[model samples]
Target: GQAASSLGSDGSGYGLAKALKHSVTCIVPALVQLKVKAHPFAKASGVRTEAKVTALIDGKEAASDTGEVQITAYGISGIPVFQISRFIALGLHQKKRSEVLLDLLPEYSEDEVYRLLVKMGDKRDDLTAKGWLTGIFNQKLVPRILEMAGVRIQTRVSELRKSQLQAVAKKCKRIILPIQDTNGFENAQVCAGGVRTKEVCPRTMESLRTKGVYITGELLDVDGICGGFNLQWAWATGCIAGKASVMRKKK
Candidate 1:
């Protein structure tokens, strides 16, 4: 966000500029990084879960991830979401329709979900429609799911109709949200593309096509997920390039 811009993402891109001048080829990844944004679907935020999340481009599943899914004010973020974010970014880059489907009750079968909802709906208690699913989902998500199922929060769970329970079951298994855009480079963990790797000597980090010039860090066509490899690559290559420059100067 604001923090990223302050870190000198001023958009001058001097590294890529220099690479361009040197005529080094660069293969940009389909995306840099993404914690995608989407149109508002849920009435609440701060929802988190570990389940199956799939990114669909043009109504087809391109990528899916499972682990943690964090619901942000803008859309979604997390390692699992991040895993499939490339497809989201790629689809958007190509102007294709992009959507993300969440299986809130992934571990349970559709029939199991329906049976559970029916069981909960029959229970008479202080639990309102909002809290009916509290035993099944995060408290914040309960209302969101009910809202998606077209139920009022104040409605009593015991009064839930069979059709309403079925709708809830369907939503529990599949919640499709239309993606709008990603949080952009500023929020990305690491850029996916840079100068082509083959253009530089691996050991010296010096440009093979343009001697006396060196490339390092994001300037090289290398990127890693959330692992420290991205930072390590930047550090290691920068050190190699620095040493190569020193040696040339001494000669």
Candidate 2:
């Protein structure tokens, strides 16, 4: 109540979605790529090269192929399983605690999960179910208690895999993970390695592999790191391609 009162009438809510949209708009084209030289200075050279990193813009290759260039990656934004489950349970149990438990109890429609919880009687809170026949796993009961068995059985009635849970965690759009080359295509900021640029006419940006098709954006093999160059490339190439598509004989 004190915290709510302190908030006053306007409320302090940040427009995350809006901020993201603006950021994406700014970053879509000028993407930057970080590259590290494997060996800045060979031992034979007798002097270290300082091992500096170069920011490669999309479309343009590294200035020097002299060194081994590697793309850098960032860590994923993932919530731990225990913390996620705790918060989920808290939100679900917010109003009328006992009634919430009763509501959740019926959610475990499967005979096995239902029977397990009923057999445990008053210790039903130790188990959680989400309906459907999936799988049952063992879990330790919360709170330090003696006489009560420490081992408790847990069954997730929802048929969701670990990958699915991770996907769901990202769906909320609140979590942010660094875009990396090793991450799944779904989690990537922009996809790389599409229609080979060699198969496309540099003058027209039209595909030679599949004539009449003009490729642009992340769909092309061209990708940049984190600047607006990608967007600039897209616009420049798209403009030329668009003009090429409707080329007419000089009359």
Candidate 3:
């Protein structure tokens, strides 16, 4: 009865029908080599699932889930994980140990951050007054980051003197967040660690380690800062690798 009612409802049934039609017409065709399977428990719960499996890159043992984990196609993805992947890939290609060194705070000097907070209190009569910070940071993050920096939100910006302002500036610039772990292969968009360039010819992307083994894409360990940089790296590396691979094959 509930299923029948849901099918008859315009808001529910109409939208669902449209989605089904689009999925069938568009999505099905794109999935050329796709595989599907259902667990009995998941089927009973009406849940559908798809999994992409990839081998562990570099042969490092899998990490436990205690830390932050983002799964991806090639491997894990995250700030610390991404940064570390560059060195890891190079090391792996050279058959050396690969590990990531993460810094929780990259920006500020500790003494500078501390001195700034003390000045804010000395300049402001009312320590709780809120002042001008919108120009310096996102308004939403300002209050929270300020609180972390030991400034009361109610403190007036006018109360901050030069030293205090400088201190606050340093803290804002150097907030620390620890790296937990990489988001694993399933959830990651690209792999971090791969073949090292020291062992690969730079211009051609030809492997110095193995003949005919041209490394490219995320497996090469070159990643860029956020935005479209990573995509550009992948495209350039892939193009070079493709050209080099063909040349190697001919030779």
Candidate 4:
């Protein structure tokens, strides 16, 4: 805000524009990843796997994606996590709580997971509960799953009660972890908030609030996800603003 306003972007000349208080109109962690206060039972050193990730704000789904979620000691990364980071960043900016729900077994329904567990229980009663799941789910995930379900890792599957199996099934399908914040602006590939787009002319990229001033690219309140959308934005807006400014000079 300071950087743009310093260049007279705060509508200094337009009597129609008042000197306004600055606030984030959208987000800051666009194309970045989220940081989390991962549950102790859900912590992983550096594991990578595919899952259906849902980011929530105040218990409502704000964003979701299905892909690789890289679990670090601190929190999650990878593209799927990046896809939802903007929502989390915005939620945090508004002082609202955010969360992430991971479906490690995206292909299976909750009931199907329970049935599979029962079938495995019938055949692998001799193996420990953790061992039984190790063959089915990722070995790296068994400990965390069992831990999340409140089951002891070494308990024999034969010793497992019906309720415990149900609990385990639920955890596998929906492991919800609270998000603390984003990885911060330094880690963002591109940012989302700047000059308000409503204050600029769409055709010319000139500031409606202050004539002859053009705001474009990351300088405006626009951003995009991965795969060069942001790159295209920068180029297109720069061209429009540049051309308009030149045409005005000729006039």
Q: Which candidate is the best by TM-score?
A: 4
Q: How many backbone clashes does candidate 1 have?
A: 0
Q: What is the lDDT of candidate 3?
A: 0.41
In terms of TM-score, how similar is model 2 to the real structure?
Answer: 0.29
Q: What number of clashing residue pairs does each candidate have, in the order they appear? A: 0, 14, 24, 0
True-structure lDDT of candidate 2: 0.31
Candidate 2 C-alpha lDDT tens digits along 1-251: 00122234111111221222211111121112221123111122321111122112232212211122221222111112111122222222332111000011222433544345334333334333322111221111111010012221243323334443333222211111112222222233443334456666898877665566666554455655334665787788889887888882231
Better of 1 and 4 by lDDT: 4
What ordering of candidates by lDDT runs from best to worst?
A: 4, 1, 3, 2
Cα lDDT listed for each candidate: 0.72, 0.31, 0.41, 0.77
Error of 2 at 16 (Å): 34
Instruction: Please give each candidate's TM-score.
Output: 0.76, 0.29, 0.37, 0.86
* Candidate 3 residue spans exceeding 4 A from truth: 1-128, 131-139, 149-170, 182-189, 226-229, 244-251
Candidate 4, lDDT over the whole model: 0.77
Candidate with the greatest lDDT versus the true structure:
4
Query: What are the C-alpha RMSDs, in order, of all predicted structures?
Result: 4.0, 22.3, 17.7, 4.6
TM-score-superior candidate, 1 or 2: 1
Q: For residue 31, what is the lDDT in candidate 2?
A: 17
Q: What order do you get sorting by TM-score, best first? A: 4, 1, 3, 2
Indicate the residue-level lDDT of 212 in model 3: 62
> Lowest summed-lDDT stretch of 10 residues in model 2?
138-147
